[model samples]
Target chain A: MKLVPLADRVVLKQLEAEETTKSGIILTSSAQEKPQEAEIVAVGPGGVIDGKEVKMNVEVGQKVIYSRYAGSEVKLDGKEYIVVRQNDILAIVED
Target chain B: MKLVPLADRVVLKQLEAEETTKSGIILTSSAQEKPQEAEIVAVGPGGVIDGKEVKMNVEVGQKVIYSRYAGSEVKLDGKEYIVVRQNDILAIVED
Candidate 1:
């Protein structure tokens, strides 16, 4: 089943890690760092949350940088996803 | 200087841990659990935060239960305190 976030939550799919350095040196899997970048998989319909009015600013397919250790991990359909509040998303990645 | 919370933040001082159980059994320091109970030391004047209008619902001197691992620890004047948002408080304790 697909994930449907509620309230101010947003579903995100993390981007793959860069295994190579700028100098074209390949790094091992253990040396790769968990990337903070992700793509919006599902956008929650923003309304009132915790007695405060909230509005969704990002859309599906938009790349974003989220706060470290901010969201919960969910495994669905053999794929991993993250569910976080809209505020946890720090910024939208441009280009 | 005393902590003055900003926005909907609240400063809390954790209550002392109970060293003895209700059964009159005294527990060692390592066996004692960190208490979730705290006394409200300061309350912020609620306003718009993250583009959402918020109103403060808590006041100083109130005893409350806060969420675990929710807020940041701050040290002021050699005193330790936790600074958390209003929503991080789970419930008010009445005695």
Candidate 2:
């Protein structure tokens, strides 16, 4: 089953460690650090959350940087994803 | 200087650990668990944050239960306080 995030939550697919890492050296998946970069796999509908009106700014397929300590890790369909509130996202990664 | 929260931020004064623990046994301050309960010391004006409109639902002197891992601790004038977003607060505790 696919993950459908609730209000103000976005589903993110973490970018491959080697792809985002600035360091030329490549590390195995298990050895890679917790990269803060990720791609928006699924965007949640922004609505009233905790009495706050949230508007989703990032669309699916956008690369973004998220807070290191934010979000919950979920393994679905053998793929790992992180579900975080829109506020947890710090910025949109530009080309 | 007094802490003035900005944009839906709330400054909370953590209740003494000994007062919150229900266990008949008493523990030293250093050994007490991270109490999730606190009293609201100051409230921020509701406004736009990250493109979302937030309204503060809490008031000063109200006891509330907040998320365990939420907010940042600040030391002001030798008094410790926690600064957290309004959403971090889970519920109000009424005696």
Per-prediction CA RMSD (Å): 12.4, 11.7
lDDT of 1 by residue, A1-95 (tens): 89999998999997665511221222111111222556899999988787777777778997664544558999999999999887666445443
CAPRI category for model 1: incorrect
Per-residue lDDT of candidate 2, residues A33-73 (tens digit): 12256788998898877776777776899876555465899
Q: How high is each candidate's interface RMSD, in Å?
A: 14.9, 14.0
**What C-alpha lDDT values do all the predictions have?**
0.67, 0.68
The residue pairs that clash in candidate 1, if any, are: none
Q: Estimate each model's TM-score.
A: 0.45, 0.46
Tens-digit per-residue lDDT, B1-95, candidate 2: 35556557787888886777753324232333233788998887757786566788899999887763546654444566666678888789887
Interface RMSD of 2: 14.0
Candidate 1 has an interface RMSD (Å) of: 14.9
DockQ of each: 0.03, 0.03
Q: What docking grade applies to model 2?
A: incorrect
